[model samples]
Target: SRAEQSRAEQSRAEQSRAEQSRAEQSRAEQSRAEQYLSKTNAQCLKGIFAIAVLCHHMYQYSGLFRGKFGIILQALGYLSVGIFFFFTGYGLIVSYQEKKEFYIKNFLRKRVLPFYLFYLFLTAIYALWRIVLNIEYTRRQLIQSIIFKDALAANSWYLQVIIVFYIFFWITAKVVKDTKKLVRMIIICSMLYCVGCFMLDVTSTRYESFLCIALGTMWAVNKKRVDKLLDIKGLQLFLLSIILFGVFCSTYIIVDNLAIQIFSKMASALAFSSMAIIFVFKLSGRAEVLINNPVTQWLGKYSLEIYVIQGIFLLLRKGTKLYIQNPYVFIVVCVIGTLLLAIVIKSVYDWIVRKCRPQVVNM
Candidate 1:
């Protein structure tokens, strides 16, 4: 009887261990599944999109890669920006969710001030460059450039949009206590902003990607529910997202009215962003090796610097001997030059931060 009881106890122990092992394995799988848009992955995506933006600007400046290639690059440029906005919205929402008080307390200093300072610095540099080059501009034009009414730098509209979004986010966070209400307000305000931009007859560039930000916010807010609803196999989910993306893109192409096309473009951007997230999540291992490699991570770390500095080069190279005649050569030079300039800017920025830290602490 004693031997039989001991054997039964051992069987129970083995069963318990098996169940624990299965539970742990399930948790590991869940964790991997949720790693779709981790911060690192997001940064890698930013790095990739940053280069896409660069290529788009290059094509705009040089008119290289004619026909379909050029068109595709141009399209990617717009989509790249939508991805950035999506990340911004998602990041802000997740940050607020994780540490409400901390995020709110340092919202301006941590979130807004750096953007303002960098933008101000870039604007000043643009102004100085124009003055040094003796570029003709009326006082009104100069003022407008400074205020972001006109582009002083290549693709400066993005800075204006992001700054506005940051301010809007800060204000909305302060005013709305309920998360659901807050998300609704954000979406409504984003749409209204788009409408205002359209009414002002601003370049389509200014408003087209804005809805992606609201979409990002919505995804972040309802991620759990959405994830649950779409909890099919990874391949199936990926295919579904691709189908959605294709549908939206087709709608964008087929739409007759410019207004409808704009809306469709925004929808397509949202679909693309979703597809990208799914792709990365499903293929995270491969993505880590290929997309999220050291080079991309480094690029992502200095993406903002690269973005701001490349515009200066664009200005400098235009109508000057500095401009490379060969498109291929120009791209090589531009990429290398932008990376070098970005590095220098980052070094200087870091040095300034290091110099200021002690004083800040003392104060």
Candidate 2:
């Protein structure tokens, strides 16, 4: 009888263990689902920002579209950077919400590595092609691009800016634990930073303000809010806001005095911020369908790859003089070509990473 009782007790213990394991598995699955959702939004926002930059560039190099339209498009160009910084801040802060210590390393490991690798690969390809074409090339230019310095004035000034913001944000999020205080400091400093940039006509300093504003805004928004922003049924509000912002900026840009330049610039920046707010709100809300949509979402995922590889298209244009006269055609070709290359390169990179992932995991 005692022996029978022991067997029954052992069976019950095993059943309890199985039940606990199932519960834990369920919780983990839920956690993964949430993370996938978060990453989808981040990718969506980044993809849009990348495309915006591309569009702004198209408008820019197309000499046919000049004057007021030109100025508005040019202003819109910088907003891409603004959107990028905001997403970075939001993504990094939210990522570190649970455990902040590993944020910097993880940022470098996942985001920076892919970027640098792709940059180096494409840069080398461009340099070789340029050499074959007998174009003037320098080791200094290569080094400058690698270090994210102001050496060549390549179209990738934004990449350097991204690296800067990543470091700045990582350090700040690490040191300043108080959320409210950090937000206040970021805002105050961003304003002062903008003032200094405007006074000096310092483009880099202006970019720094974008970083602070983005991170500050991200720190302000939460997960529940993010979901609502992603729901795309409310997209009209976002589109309308963007249009109004554009109009306001165009008006400001046409007024050509020094004081007005400063004010207009400020107005333009504010418009960008306003647009960003609406974008994030809608992105995090019901309008997320646009972002969560399969094609846009996939493009969003690999947008960084597109950013890095797009330079190859620029190099091709410079080398072949293709679509040089027709600005719109040039941009269209460049965009299409860059996207194709990005896909190819990203596929190879992902395969290699997956193959070597065990080593990475061990490390």
Q: Whose TM-score is greatest here?
A: 1
Evaluate model 2: give its TM-score: 0.68
Q: List the residue pairs that clash in candidate 1.
A: none
Task: Name model 2 segments beyond 4 Å from true.
Answer: 1-37, 67-72, 104-118, 132-134, 151-153, 188-201, 204-251, 258-263, 276-288, 320-329, 348-363
lDDT of 1 at 257: 82
Candidate 2 lDDT by residue in tens digits, 1-363:
999999999999999999999999867654543444366766776787777766666665555568867765776656666666666666655666655566554655566665556556656776776665455767887887678754243355666666565566556666787655556556666666666766777664345336435443544455555444544343665676677667756666576676565555555555565456556554443355766688778788778777656665555446543325566667878788878877897887786455433244454
What's the TM-score of each model vs. the native? 0.86, 0.68
What number of backbone clashes does candidate 1 have, counting pairs of residues 3 or more apart or in separate chains?
Answer: 0
Scored against the true structure, residue 304 in model 2 reaches a CA lDDT of 72
Model 2's number of clashes is 23
| Model 1 Cα lDDT, one tens digit per residue, 1-363 | 999999999999999999999999878767766776788878888988888888888888776788978778888877888888899888888888888766877777666666666676677777777666666567786678667777676566788788878888888889897777888999999999888878888778888888889888888899887666555665787787788778877887777888878877777787778777767766654445676788889888887777778876665456443445777777777888899888888876565444433234454
For every model shown, the clashing-pair count is 0, 23
